[model samples]
Target: TQLLEQSPQFLSIQEGENLTVYCNSSSVFSSLQWYRQEPGEGPVLLVTVVTGGEVKKLKRLTFQFGDARKDSSLHITAAQPGDTGLYLCAGIGNTGTASKLTFGTGTRLQVTL
Candidate 1:
């Protein structure tokens, strides 16, 4: 079975702090997605990396797809209080298995002033 697990369920930091969130799995992912959600809204897509060993940078955040397509990582540099949110990772479900994806438990990031 394919499952994605995330580490550091909670993170509290001061402004300008840097952190890295990890996602691991035993099964390969056709595509991996990273999402962030605010207090009362749905998750917003941050980035989606499909190629193994690929990396994408969005201003202060960096996303990497594992060489094996079984893992991924998100690194934030100079984090701000506005960065506070719930981070999520998801992978496409296998056809005829489960139509929906298995997501990480989630990482609650709290950036304070």
Candidate 2:
């Protein structure tokens, strides 16, 4: 079981700008998921990628999984102040009934108008 790693611990950008966050791991996973979180609330699942080389887009957000299933990326377009929050990536380890997820360190984004 490999641990997920996220880059750019923090990011500050102005509204209308764009950014991409990355998640990497040494071990391959069955699936990868991205989430957004606020200070006082639980994380909200943004996207999930299960197949290699698969890409999913949600409005202005794009999520891509590496061909090897060991990495993923999240890209945001025209970021808005409401997009500022904690972003997390989680790799789902397939262990049957004992399945577990390895979460990335986390990336905090601040979008200013």
Candidate 3:
């Protein structure tokens, strides 16, 4: 079993600021997914990175996959109060006929104006 860990369990920033969150694991993952969860709601998918060293951008947010597929990072530029939420990274691995998802400890972000 692979365990994914995220740094800075809590983050508080002002509006229009920039921040980066990290996710790391010792085992390699076939694919990695990032999600954001707001209060009283389930997490929403942000992005998925399948290729090593690949980077994907979503509006003001950027997602990067490590070259070894063992780590990933999410960067939010000009963060808004609406961006406040719980960020989670999930590692997906295929086990024969089934796929297993291991989620990180999670990072809670609060953006205040």
Candidate 4:
């Protein structure tokens, strides 16, 4: 199992700013996923990177996986107030079950106007 670590536990920024969040692990993962959560709701998956050095972009967000499969990053361009939420990264060692995922602590982003 991989243990995930996220950087910048808390972030506060203005609209139109750009930010990057990181997730690192010592162990390799079969797949890694990024998620965003609102105050009162569960996390929603943003993107899943299964291949090493893979990058996936969603609108203004970009997700990248490390070539060694031990790390990942998320970059947001031109932040928006509506993007405020708790971002999470989850590493999966195997595809067996939902219980096998190791989740990062999380990065709380507050984008202000």
Candidate 5:
């Protein structure tokens, strides 16, 4: 069974703090993607890495795909109140519908101003 699980289901931090969230699974994935969504809004794609050991960065946010393709991580260098949101990782399965994406449990981050 392929599934993505996120750590620290909840996080509360002051402004300008650094944090990292992990996504792990025992099954391999064709592609791994990260997304962030604000309250009452849909998730917005942040980055997608198809190759193993791939690293992508978006400003203060960094993402890494495991060499085994079974895990991923998101590192935030410095977070602000504007960075507060739900961070999610999605694994695109090799089988099943092409557009199917299995999402992680999600990590709600609160950056206090």
Candidate 6:
């Protein structure tokens, strides 16, 4: 079983600011996904990195998978209040019959104007 940990459990920033959130694990993952959850709603998929050293950009957000496949990072440039939410990183592992998803502790981001 792999345990994922996210840094800066809480983050408060102003509009147009930049920030980076990290997800780390001791075990390797076949793939990883990042999600953003708003209050009173389920998380929405943001991006997925399958290959090691892969980087995907969604608008102002950039997602990077570590070369070792054991870590990932989410960088947001010019953050806006719309970006405020609970950010989660989930590691996907295939267990033959099924796929297991292990989610990180989570980082709550609050972007103010």
Instruction: Tell me the tens digit of each residue's lDDT in model 3 across 1-113.
Output: 79999988999999999999999999999999999999899989999999999999999999999999999999999999999999999999755556667999999999999
Cα lDDT over the full model 1: 0.91
The TM-score-based order of candidates, best leading, equals: 6, 3, 2, 5, 4, 1
Positional deviation of residue 13's Cα in model 6 after best superposition, in angstroms: 0.4
Please, what are the lDDT tens digits per residue for candidate 1 over residues 32-74?
A: 9999999889989899888999999999999999999999999
Q: Rate the local accuracy (lDDT) of all candidates.
A: 0.91, 0.94, 0.95, 0.94, 0.93, 0.95
Off by over 4 Å in 3: none
lDDT of 2 by residue, 50-106 (tens): 999999999999999999999999999999999999999998886677656688999
| Candidate 1: stretches off by over 4 Å | 94-99
Which stretch of 10 consecutive residues in model 2 shows the poorest summed lDDT? Answer: 93-102
**Model 5 ranges off by over 4 Å:** none
Q: How close is every model to the real structure, measured as TM-score?
A: 0.93, 0.96, 0.96, 0.94, 0.95, 0.97
- Which pairs of residues collide in candidate 6? none
Give residue 16's error in model 2 in angstroms. Answer: 0.6
Per-model C-alpha RMSD: 1.7, 0.9, 0.9, 1.5, 1.0, 0.8
Q: Give the poorly placed runs of model 6, Cα more than 4 Å off.
A: none
> What 10-residue stretch in candidate 5 is worst by lDDT?
93-102
lDDT of 4 by residue, 21-113 (tens): 999999889999999999989999999999999999999999999999999999999999999999999988855666466899999999999
lDDT of 5 by residue, 1-112 (tens): 6778999899999998999999999999989899999989999999998999999889999999999999999999879998899999999988877768889999999999
Query: Model 6, 72-109: lDDT tens per residue?
Result: 99999999999999999999975555666799999999
Give the true-structure RMSD of model 5.
1.0
lDDT of 3 at 16: 94
Provide the global lDDT of candidate 6 against the true structure. 0.95
